[model samples]
Target: MLFRQLFDAESSTYTYLIADHTTKAAVLVDPVLEQVERDLKLLKELGLILHYCLETHVHADHVTGTDRLRQATSCSGIVPDRAHVACADRHIKDGETLHLGDITITAIATPGHTDSHMAYLVNDDRVLTGDALFIRGCGRTDFQSGDAGTLYDSVTKHLFTLPDETLVYPAHDYRGHTVSTIGEEKRWNSRFAERDGRGANRLRHRPSFIEFMNHLNLPDPKKIMEAVPANEMCGHLAATA
Candidate 1:
């Protein structure tokens, strides 16, 4: 089991490279468009053939490089069935597993960050927790189909049930922390701590949807409306005329 995690500073997104040492068969998870060149260069240098490009959810931050990577490497793009993206070759549902030589990654539906969010559990130990769970906090449950109460349930019931030592690799982290263990998050995560009434609960005072929308600082996603249709259909822009 060989793995490398890459971070995009601009969007605080994390892209992962996991490979089987014996076969050099690899997969890229949640790749950002800006980093595609670098990612491909590294993969080529390592003598690894990309077998799959997995999207945890339809992103709202940066454009994905799924189509570009597929064009370059002829890799299949994998995404959750609930996501309406245009480039996926395989639309996986919960409990479905993808195999790469000796490695098997199982998908687990974790729908709080988005309606189609998924957490990929590798060998039932390491989890790529998309935007669902972070080191000190969780994703904001105000976007898409997000519901705070539902997020609470997803965290406490689905994710927290993993063993304490299971490593958690989140989709984005601006703080420069690359990875965390379930035990560490369980003990130190402020969001869960607050939920347990052990500390200050800032989320308790959050405004209603209308009021929250009024104060949202985020801009509309770049090419989101366009990306969705193309992504959902798995269509890529042709490189040549």
Candidate 2:
């Protein structure tokens, strides 16, 4: 197995590249359009075949490189079915398996950040959590039709169920932290601590989570007005549109 975690400083986003060294086949998860040339160059230099560009959800913060990568590599574009992007080469449903040579990727429907958000479990060892789960703090549930309660359930119930040692790779982290484990997050995540501070026994984590989410007045992504529409079109922009 070949793996690399690439970062974009401007967006503070993490793009992943995974490949099966034996077959020289690879895929990029949550690719950013601005980094397309870099990603393409890496694939070419490594003598790898681009297989698929997998999006965790319809992101409002940054335009995706899926469309452009497809044009350059003939790789398929795979986005969550619920996103309704319509232009994706394939719409993957929950529990579906995606393959890269000998590697198998399973789609885990985690939702919350956006209704169709997904986290990919790579061969049961590492989970690509997208924006649904982050290090110490989860994604703000105040925008993009996000739901705090649902996100809480998705994390505590679904993601946390993975083995304590399972590696967590999130899509974005503003701070310098790069990775976390399921156990570490369950223990120290401030968002979870906030839920506990509300007295889980009385308010319950769900209600507290909802209240917490409602009160967070985080600003909208600076690029949402432009990025959303472009992402909806699979990250294509006409000179005039």
Candidate 3:
């Protein structure tokens, strides 16, 4: 397998590039519009064919490069089936599989950052957690129809079920840290750490966590007005306007 992790400073977004060793078929996750050229150059230099462009959610922070990527590489644009985006070329549901050569990517609905968010499991080893789970702190659940309780379940129930050694790659990180394992997060996660398996099983502390998140007076994303609507059409704002 071939993998690359790229970062965007304006939005603190992390774009991922993954490819199969045998066929050189590739896919990109959470690409930003500003970094499309860099992503394409890497693809060209590696002699890999772009097969898929995947989105975890319709972002409210920065515009997606999906439109430009599709135009440049002719890759299929995939999003969760429940996403409000009308421009997704492929609508994947939970448990659905996507193939790039022999590599398999499975969609796991992990909403709460947004109603349609999904974290993808790649080849059953690593998981691209998106904004659902981060290195230490999770995404703010104050907007975009976010629910703190659902996010708690997404982590403790769905994501934590993955192998403890599973590598976690998130979509954004304000800190310099780039990667972590499920085991590390389970132990040190700022919000949900220190709970036993049975505690997580009962969501023993989920309500208090949700209540805290609900009461947090966070500010709206800087680009929400522009980014959200543009991203809804795969970042082609004029197409809908």
Candidate 4:
């Protein structure tokens, strides 16, 4: 199996490229529209066939490259089940798996960043945490049908149950952190875990987490206006209303 992480500077987004070396079949997860050409060139140079473009959710931070990639290659555009992407070629549900030869990508429903978000577990080892759980922080729950309490439950009940050593690859990272382990995040992610007075990290109470999230007062993403609509159409600007 071959796994590569590609970054889009403009949106601070990370697109993933996962493929099976033996079959040369590849899938791009959470791709950004601006980086489509770079992604295509990489696939071509690697002698791989683009099989699918999988979106974690309908993004507000940046438009997806699925439509452009679908036009360039015979790839299907796949989105999370129930996501408002009417143009997607497929909708993947929780526990559903997509195979690229030996590579296994299983979807785990982890909403709250949006009403329908998914984190992909690759081969049961590494997790591609779209936007639900970031390295030190988590996604905001102030918009797009987001709920702070729901995000807390998804992270603690669903994501935190995975193996402690499972690799955490988030969709976006502004702190230059590329990857982390589940154990590390559980122990150190300030948004989910608070430091005790004695210097130990403890799981933050749900009420505290929710309260803090609700009062963040963060600004909306600059691209939200255009990005959301375009993403809903699978990145087809012309089709966006």
Candidate 5:
């Protein structure tokens, strides 16, 4: 398996190119619009054909390049079944697996950041966490049907159960920390550490949604409204042009 992790400094977003070296087939995860040209250029240089473009969620940050890339390269755009994005060629459900040459990617429905959010588990060991889990902190549950207790459950019940060594690659991070292991985050994350009890008790005592959002300090995603609709429609502007 060959992988390239690309970073956009402006939004602190990371896009991934996971490929099978033998087949020269690749898939992109959570791509940013501004980095589309660079991403496509690199793919061309690498002698690889893009098989799919995947989104973890409908982003509130930068516009997704999935539509433009799909039109440019004729690649399929894959997103969660619950996502209302029109550009998605395939709507994947939890436990659904996608084949990219020799590699297999599984979709895990991890709703907290947004109701339709997903986390892609790649090759069993690596996960594209989207905005759900950051290196040290988890995503804020204050917007777009975001709930603190739901987020807590998703983290402790769904994600934390993965192997301790599972590599966690998040979508954005303002801090320089690029990546971490499930075990590392499980032990060190302050939010999870403070939550007491299990199941009902955990949910009952969870922090207020407002309080949690306040601490997150997340800036409004640049041009979100413009970006989202365009992205959902598979780069409508780029497609038309």
Candidate 6:
């Protein structure tokens, strides 16, 4: 298995490139539109064929590169089931696995940040937590049908159930961190856990978590007006217009 984490500094988005070393079949997860050339170059240089372009949800941050990439290659565009992406070649459901040679990517339904979001587990060793769980914080539950309590449940029950040693690769990072383990996040992530008076890490209560999230008052993403509608059309901006 070959894995590469690519970043788009403008949106603080992380686009993942995963491939099977034996067959050279590759998939790009959450790719940004502005970075398509770079991704294509990398794939060409590595002698890999782009098999799929996967989206976790309809993004409200930056436009996706799936449409552009598909135009350039023979890759299929895949989005999470229930996503409003009509142009998607396929919609992946929770627990559904896509095989790239020996590597398997399974989708985990985690809908809070967005009503139709997914977090993918790769080969049971690493998880690509796309906008659902970040390095130390989680996505804001203030829009796109987002709910604080639902987000809390998704993180505490669904994500936290993974193996403690499983590697967590988020879709975006604003704090210069790259990767973290499930145990590390469960113990230290302030959004999910906090240090008790006894100096032990404990999960934040659901009600409290909900209250905290509701009060965050985060501003909308800069590109929401264009990104959301465009993403719904599988990243073809003109289609939504």
Which lDDT tens digits does candidate 4 get at residues 1-241? 9999999999999999999999999999998888989999999999999999999888999988899899999799999999988989999999999999999999999998889999999999999999999998899998999999999999999999999999999999999999999999999999999888999889999999999999999999999999998998999993333
Provide the RMSD of all predictions against the true structure, rounded to 1 decimal.
3.8, 2.6, 2.9, 1.4, 3.6, 1.3
* TM-score of candidate 5 relative to the true fold: 0.89
RMSD of 2: 2.6
**Model 5 spans with C-alpha error above 4 angstroms:** 195-219, 237-241
What are the clash counts of all predictions, listed in order? 9, 0, 0, 0, 1, 0
**1 versus 5: better TM-score goes to:** 5
Q: What is the lDDT of residue 47 in candidate 4?
A: 99
Give per-residue CA lDDT, model 1, range 63-114, as digits (tens): 6778889889999999987787644788899999988888999998888777
What does candidate 2's lDDT look like per residue over 62-94, in tens digits?
A: 988888898899998999877979888888998
- Tens digit of lDDT per residue, candidate 3, span 171-198? 9999888999988888788666745656
Query: How many clashes (backbone atoms < 3 Å, residues ≥3 apart in a chain or on different chains) does model 3 have?
Result: 0
Candidate 5 residue lDDT tens string, 188-223:
776665455442222323565336655776766776
Worst 10 residues of 2 by lDDT: 195-204
lDDT of each: 0.79, 0.87, 0.88, 0.94, 0.82, 0.93
> How would the candidate models be sorted by lDDT, starting from the highest?
4, 6, 3, 2, 5, 1
Q: In angstroms, what RMSD does candidate 1 have relative to the true structure?
A: 3.8
The C-alpha local distance difference test score for the whole of candidate 1 amounts to: 0.79
**Between 3 and 4, whose TM-score is larger?**
4
Give the C-alpha lDDT of model 2: 0.87
